[model samples]
Target: MLQMANYEFIRKQHILLGKPIRQISRETGYSRQVIRKALKSTKIPVYQLSKPKPKPVIDSVQPIILEWLRQDEQAPPKQRHTATRIYQRLVDEYGFTGGESTVRRYVRQLRVSPPKAFVPLDFPPGKFAQFDWGEVTVLLQGKQVKVQVFCMRCTYSRKIFVKTFFHQKQESLLQGHVDAFEFFGAVPQTVTYDNLTTAVKKVLEGKNRVEQERFVQLRAHYLFESHFCDPGKGHQKGQVENLVKFVQKQFFTPVPCVSSLEELNYFLLEKCISYETTTVPRSSLTVGEAFEQEQQTMLPLPPQPLDCCRVVSVKSNTLSMIHFEKNAYSVPVSYASTELTCKVFAERVEVYHGNKLIAEHERCLESGKELLQYDHYLDL
Candidate 1:
């Protein structure tokens, strides 16, 4: 376990300073898992030295009281002695004169700590944002497949963006933000997250973070702050946390029968925008109305959207195919046995041979799947 000081640093950096875990890890040299462990604990994990209390009154009776309680551990829950019963028994048997309240207090200490309360939070207009991913089951091609729902919501205005992806990848992470920001027509000042692997590479002590290189590039492009909720502390980002559940229940309760993620996401976008007319708690204005007000405070959208895609070079086989991320895509036959470039966009893959476009195919998410364009084979 990390010392309380280290835990405090993770919380401050991740939750307050809006630093990503990767930045923390690079700065502190602590593993992301360790950082998360420290974050899960709300209280600092400091070991305080217990000062000896002047318990001369209970000193002699302490052993007797312990033995009785230890034996009672075997008794039925109903039959176990209550505090009053124990105090009476002490006076009748061993003649303990300690106050009943004192005995009751000691007994309480032996029990497990009480459950923590969920803290309530609200955001000021255009000040905060939240991002999270939730899984939903969809019926595609007569098979039930799980898909990732990337959700981003403006905390104050309740404006949101919902998109679906076949998997969660770093590219998808950046793309989700780009789409969300474009949808909202502005960028939020700070965005909160849980320790999502795409953006965070490590968790470090206090205000220090090691963010993913690509993530850092995305941050630099849009210039929004990144905040991470404590590990297991979803309540810190409770709005999106609840939104995750809400998306599943409200949008996906009836399993969506769709041919592709794009179709389902189109449906989700409508649902997202529909929330605009609903009134938020303690507010007279609709969600859309609040968003309209918050829009004035937002940072203007960039002139050109960031191209958040992953580009890589791969050697094409004799069959004019190249494998990437466990899936195979094809290029023109003339490019066979040569090094071809693949630009992986959010929804499609573009194959290029020396800057000339050879082929384009819709990206596939299923593992070990191959997409072949008949035009590429037509030359043969």
Candidate 2:
């Protein structure tokens, strides 16, 4: 069989370079007839025909195999059977004698369409939203750091709220919901989430989830229903999942640099709000227009927002700094060698001495990081 490269080279040399066929044969090493054939053809060389493999065993079990593959459309991607597993099933259940490679080869040719059809989803205003977290890298104070970005998307408006946190712990998760609700100016009636550890304490059968206590508190306070996707089925909350990447790509691209995480998040929030004016997919209206309709159906904000702060009292070290979660923040030098109360909020840390606020510093996300407020101390 003539190889493709020789044919390509021959065609290129003869047709494009205006080289004669005898010279082409001398340079390419081909018969005149083969060269003539190559010159006449515009298409690439391909095998004339493929003979079907003989599969006596597979012939009997082919029906069974197709049924299982068809049923796999509904199975979770991880739980679906592999070619080897399917072969095993055929051998065990149907008493079929077939080589695993044959089964694998046949299965490779098999495919089923997605179980769910692609269709437009319409959400009633304020009726639905999606929440999720995405990992993003940012340069904070000249140090590169990884942070979790919490994303919430209103299903109706496609309006979004984005916040970044060093940890996806309960405190950050709850605080994200609190802040997002405050930003949206209303709470969605229903929120969808994958079985995120910060929200789900235990996964029950089917779509049931025993949510974390803090997550439950958030739901109760906001009076919104919480929905969890089936195991390995995050597509149910695809809106926020895409928004998570949207936040990372469109918002975090060029790798945002900021003096503090708080500053970076403020920039992201502005970007999120600005997205409202942009047109939504498959809809003629802008996100702001959709959200405006949603706002009417969305539940009203609570009289008081949840206390999303985590407060702890720590004794100030000789350096007049208090430590929390491996990060240290300085208070007034007078607080050195004294016990002070430190209240840690999502974006800042407040230090108090005997019920008097002494110092406040931007929250730090890294271990062994030190935050010192300029007004807290005067160097000797």
Candidate 3:
């Protein structure tokens, strides 16, 4: 290959000095064809390989490595094989005697090329949203505690709502949706999610889900549809998945210290509201501006929000306490040994006798502890 200096000299000789290609070649490298090519263009040519170099050692194990990588596409994200793991497997399982570096280079090449193609999805206003749960660590009253983050992102506007909860229980999940819908001031036509146990009882074949009964009730009350991503395909709901990370990094970074989860949630809510002025990518409109337009197309908020809770029927024991979630709560002595309905919420548990609300108490986090209200036992 001719250096750029040599090529430039040849071109200047013929083009600037008015010298013929034949004379230039004779004066420079004595190659008429090379001189003519340089004079024809001012740009320097970059050399490229006509074919990839051979990998003799890797060629034998190439098929095995490729098969493992293909299988990894369906495996759980954390369980997928690393290049080191693959190299070890090759050595142990196949008794290969190649350098690990060689296997690594070939593995990286296979992973980089032939990138997976994804169809670009476009959502119209009010079409859908994505929901996801993420975990974050925060200092609660000077103690480190891990909390579940509920994230919802509007598909078109990219507006987000984030809240923290003690757990991703069914009640908390339903309440998250309720709060998110109210935050946005309207419900979207559909919401996308992973096959979370709180929402999906069973993941049926291909996108179908046996949604939990409480989750179904939430949808019925709001008049919206629920869509579950395929198993191990978190990318299907990439919007909220990204939001989950964003909240952790942007909002919770440095590990917020608050007196209570309620105070932490207030901070999160303020951060979400402040994001409304931020611009969306590939568009000029701010998130709040886009959300304003989207609100027009969204479904109207129902007359009332859904009662976000889980109901379980339990009979009071001989001690005049009904057991729920391994915790017992007192009811009136008259209602002892009678079947009652317990509506469990994130913050509290309400026990109902027939149609009347009989007892309400703050939900206890620990198991095997009985919560007794003095008023409930006063009639004893």
Candidate 4:
């Protein structure tokens, strides 16, 4: 048992530091022979190797296979010519006499190697957050419509925050982060996300990434670094992926409704808090209590909340109305021809001119044909 323990300790140290057996022996004052023996004796091979055989007849067809692979590089993956097909084509079109097995062996060698994906071994509480988006059908004014849910989760604590939005645009994505951070009462050190186009514009080699300007600004404002998962790897954000289902079942199952987005968000906030108060499976502590403890370890919140909404200049149309989304809002008759900036949020719309609030309208409740009236603007 002692020998086994020593072997495990040394093997683990080797894996953690990625040092060679000779180097480990040199540093630890163990004999090179002993280190080598221990590694050879205790190491469990992941897969057994097959016995080597004489080079096959396929070696002669390597050049042809390589040529065909190169020619098919730009073709669609499914449409790409395979070795078997190539061999058949050669037999039918040309007079080549190569065997199918030989051609397949050569073709296997020409396949582009799959890229290695990064997998984190362990992530500590408040160290990283993973985010993703999910969609669900919910009743809106007795009619069912699809709603997008933004899901974020802390890797270590398994704490989750979910919010529903209409779209997955940059504005919604940035606003989701702000709301998520505020919900958690602290900011994580690093955020992990998939290659969402709203956030990442391009993912360069060596994992060097370029993000949209607004997302970069949002990260800077929140003082957290961003890590993007490789494209086509949704499981890289597994924590949030799991939370998406959890939120859908635990929170959205009954399909609650409200007259406005503000009320819906208010109910969502309450549900999130209530979820945090329940005991997390396999852990004795409630999520809220765990989050409170986690919060102590996290960075303090910023003095001011992030301004996630965007200001857009809108021109009044001939009907003395301004268009925000598909919905129209009426301005004063005197200001019908003037341009004004509209401050849009998840639930509210505020029209302003030089810091002076002109009209505040609670955004339209349902999607189609809804309008914020001129008489309503006068009350504000």
Candidate 5:
């Protein structure tokens, strides 16, 4: 075979080089008929054809395997069933008598679509802060549990603020930002966030975005703009992502537990301050100190703290009441059941009757349901 290939190569060169095939045959001491055939054929050497391998019985199960794969693809990644589990299920539920190898081959053929690329970003100083939530599992009162930690980082300063909460619902999410802004003592000109449902209602193309009404009010209160990264492009806020992992390692590595979320957040804030102190001590600058300097450049806090509470009219026909989130308060019984405005701050609620203070009460705690006793409104 090697010799035949070499002869074919030389014959082609002779023909292209304008040498006569008969003279080349004579010089090479080869048969005139063989040389004539090679020149006339003008075809590359055709290797012997190997027989096709027989299709295994697994090929028959391709349809079933593909159907399973499609179903898995449509399911959430966290909830999607695994291949081995799916194979066992097929055997038990569908009475699939196929061999394991067949199932494995089909599963290997399934491919997941690649995530979109991160959009390039150029962050300006005091311009953007990236926010995210991370879940950390810890032993609470000897019971294993998970807590959501809110993480925020300034893109330029690299300063970070972390706070833990029981849930990531809208109230907690908005409250986290308010607390973070207060902790930094400033608000970024433009804040960046993931496509969290709490903040963003819908994301449109051409950098247009729609935000939840409450979140929009939150933004307006702070006088800062909002931007969201393309879905799944977390690297757009890589600083905060690293900050989340850094907190996990520095604070949660040993799985420390405390009596309450407030206690955990207190310690986490202290640790963050300590870490920032060590980062640039020679310059005598801490993260807090740098943030204080940055605050000078930031937009001043609104004339008042942002109102994070929601307003709901109390359902009473006689006695007027106002509901601020989960807790309810009673106002003048005169405006009862009528729609009245309520102003809620971090720690207090002010019930108004057309710009008149009808009632005021400290926000209630989980145990203090009767904070606003209706009888107290008798004098009003």
Candidate 6:
């Protein structure tokens, strides 16, 4: 291949200087045939393959690889098979004798596709936030356990809040918002979310949604609007989606060793506070500075935050216990066989008799367990 500059020189020498092709090739150390082509046309010379290289081993497994790639389109993003995994699977299942590099090259060719274009989105300060749930594994009591993480991010300041829970139930979802509002000291005008079952009961056409009743109550209490992304389009709330990965990599790396979720949450809270002082990419001010300015425009906190809980009405059995969520919770003996309201919180369960609180106990995650308070049975 001839450089553009050399090609120009060769053409100029032959056409303008009246130099012969033989003389130009001798002077430039290029072949006579090359000098002739360059003089004939001023275009830069490039080498083009007449045909693609053959892949003997990989060709045999193309169908298998294509099948796997198609299946990956429906699989979870994080759990999709990587190049290494594909190679291992080939060797194990098909006794593939090809080298990993060969398979990787073929896979890369198959995976290449045109990229999608996106419009840049702008959000006003204190007006928008996004929420989502992520999963991570942490060491609790020296044992590895999986936990759900509730993540919220301010679209303007990029401020983040994260908390871990054992489940992604309705109670956890509501409590996450309550805690996040307290952390920000104000409420965003509108919060964005996906079509999560905890928040949305049904997704209608376009942006319309049949929201969960409890979730609507939460919005009404805080006087904030809710926005839900389109079905299967997680990129609509792209800020919080990225925030989930950022927290997982920056905070959850090394698999935090802690005694309980409380200890882990406290550490995470401290980390989030510390993160405010650092600068974000393509921004001059620290996150804390932006957050401070954004706070001025945010809605003021209400006189009281919403009490997030799931209320279940049940009648106490003859055993002076109310069964909820497949577990029996002891109430006062006097309330035996009486109707009571069970308020289930993320951390505790409270039984209320005619709006008067009766029994309170730590919430048990497991089922079929009896949570008996000795004082509740004292009358017996």
Stretches of candidate 6 exceeding 4 Å from the true structure:
1-44, 48-111
Give residue 214's lDDT in candidate 5 (0 to 100): 91
**203-292: candidate 3 lDDT, tens digit per residue:** 877877788888889989999888988888999898888888888899989899999889998988999999999998778999999999
TM-score, per-candidate, Cα-based:
0.69, 0.65, 0.83, 0.64, 0.57, 0.77
lDDT tens string, model 2, 1-380? Answer: 68778778888998899999899888767889999988788577776747876668678888888889889989999999899999898888878777999899888878544576777787877899998889988889989989988889998889999998888877888899999999999999999988889789899987788887767888889999998888888888889888887777888898988997779888988898889899978889999998888899999999999977666888998887889989988888877889888877776788888789988887776789988776767852
The C-alpha lDDT values of all candidates are: 0.86, 0.86, 0.89, 0.76, 0.73, 0.91
lDDT of 6 by residue, 206-268 (tens): 999999999999999999999988788999899899899998999999889999999999999
The reply for model 2, stretches above 4 Å from the true place, is 1-104, 110-119, 141-143, 205-210, 257-259, 313-323, 327-341, 352-359, 368-380
TM-score rank order: 3, 6, 1, 2, 4, 5
Q: Model 6: how far is 78 from its true place, Å?
A: 18
Say which candidate scores most in lDDT. Answer: 6
Q: Which runs of model 1 end up more than 4 angstroms from their true locations? A: 1-119
Q: Which model, 1 or 2, shows the larger TM-score? A: 1
Q: After best superposition, candidate 1 residue 141: deviation in angstroms?
A: 3.4
Residues 1-380, model 5: lDDT tens digits: 32567666667668677777677777777677767767666566566759855656665666876787778778888887677777788888777777776677667666655777765555555777888899998777777779898998886566888988766777677788888888787888888888989888888995688889999989888989987888888877787888898888878999987776667788988976776654432346666566666666777677677657656444433545555555567766676777666765444667766777777887664542545566746867
Model 6: what TM-score?
Answer: 0.77
Of 2 and 4, the candidate ahead on TM-score is 2
Could you tally the backbone clashes for each prediction? 13, 0, 0, 1, 3, 0
Q: Which residue pairs in candidate 4 have backbone atoms (N, alpha carbon, C) closer than 3 angstroms, thus clashing?
A: 276-288
Among all windows of 10 consecutive residues in model 1, the one with the lowest summed lDDT is: 44-53
Candidate 5's C-alpha runs over 4 A off are 1-99, 102-124, 135-148, 164-174, 232-235, 245-249, 252-264, 278-304, 311-328, 332-339, 345-348, 360-380
